[model samples]
Target: MRRWLVLVSVAAALAGGCSQAQDASSIETTARDFFGAVSDEDGQRACALLSSDARESLETGGDSCDEEITKLRLEGGEAGRPEIWGEQARVRMGSDTVFLTRWASAWRITAAGCERRVGEPYDCEVEG
Candidate 1:
């Protein structure tokens, strides 16, 4: 019985790790798709990936999200490995850092075009 319990524990641990890896991969994919849309000048598609608050941030002063998002010209190179904690994740790219949050069953970009600031939270061009 003890041996069986040990085996079950090992299996559970492995499953948890695999689940985290899958979450990371999904976050990375979302990040890549967002950047790709931006690169392709598909503002509509890019806006679709953003969280509601983030999207709303772009729509100000009578400017729509699709119009304002492309105007900023956010740049992000190849996506690096993502770090995820709970429902939040951060993906670092060659030129930018993106922050995401799990919304329902999917991940959405809460902030993009972020830069590190000394003694302060990340400064993002697009943030919720």
Candidate 2:
């Protein structure tokens, strides 16, 4: 059920403009690095890979961004192909789906551990 939802949301996000890049390789690389950081339990590095908005979101409540991010228990695997549209991108791994947006010269994660909803947006564990 969740996989279906993520797929749908990814498809929906891709319906917008074409990817700004000639190919989505850069987006894939960014997603891979983000997940690798998480898997390695390098909270600071993971946080650095997020969009400012996502960083702010992670830092909400009483925890610092780095502390909060590590507490989420995120799991990731090798990334599959990426779907990018303009500044937005979706990358799927073996167990999770990540959403990213381009900011300045880099791609940053906007959401992770996202699951699709029947009539709403993807529900993400980490979202900006």
Candidate 3:
């Protein structure tokens, strides 16, 4: 019985590790797609990847989300490994950092074009 319990514990640990890896991969993919859309000038596609609140934030100035997103000229390059915490995640790219939240079954960008400031919260070009 003790051996069986030990085996089960190991299996559970492995499973959790796998799940974390999967989540990280998904987060990176989402971040990359957002950057790709921005680089390709596909405003509609990029906007679709944003969280609802983020989309609304872009439109708060009476400008369309698509138009505003494009105008920001957000820059990103190869995505680094994502740091995930429950439903929230942060991915750093070459020139920018993006924050995301898992909504439903997909990851959506909550903030993009972020830069770290000493002793302050990240300043983002687009945030909800």
lDDT of 2: 0.83
Candidate 1 lDDT over 15-45, as tens digits, reads: 9999899999999989999988998889899
TM-score of each: 0.95, 0.78, 0.95
Q: How close is candidate 2 to the true structure, as a TM-score?
A: 0.78
Stretches off by above 4 angstroms in model 2 are 1-23
- What are the per-model numbers of colliding residue pairs? 0, 0, 0
> Candidate 3 has what TM-score?
0.95
lDDT for 7 (candidate 3): 100
Model 2 lDDT per residue over 1-128, tens place? 99999999998778533444434777877778887888777889999999999999988788888888888867877788888776788988767889999888788899998877899988898999
Model 3 weakest lDDT span, ten residues long: 60-69
* Model 1 lowest lDDT segment of ten: 70-79
Error of 3 at 12 (Å): 1.2
Query: Model 3, which residues run further than 4 Å from truth?
Result: none
> Model 3, range 23-89, lDDT digits (tens) per residue?
8998998989998998888989999999999999999667899888988968898889899888999
lDDT ranking of the models: 1, 3, 2
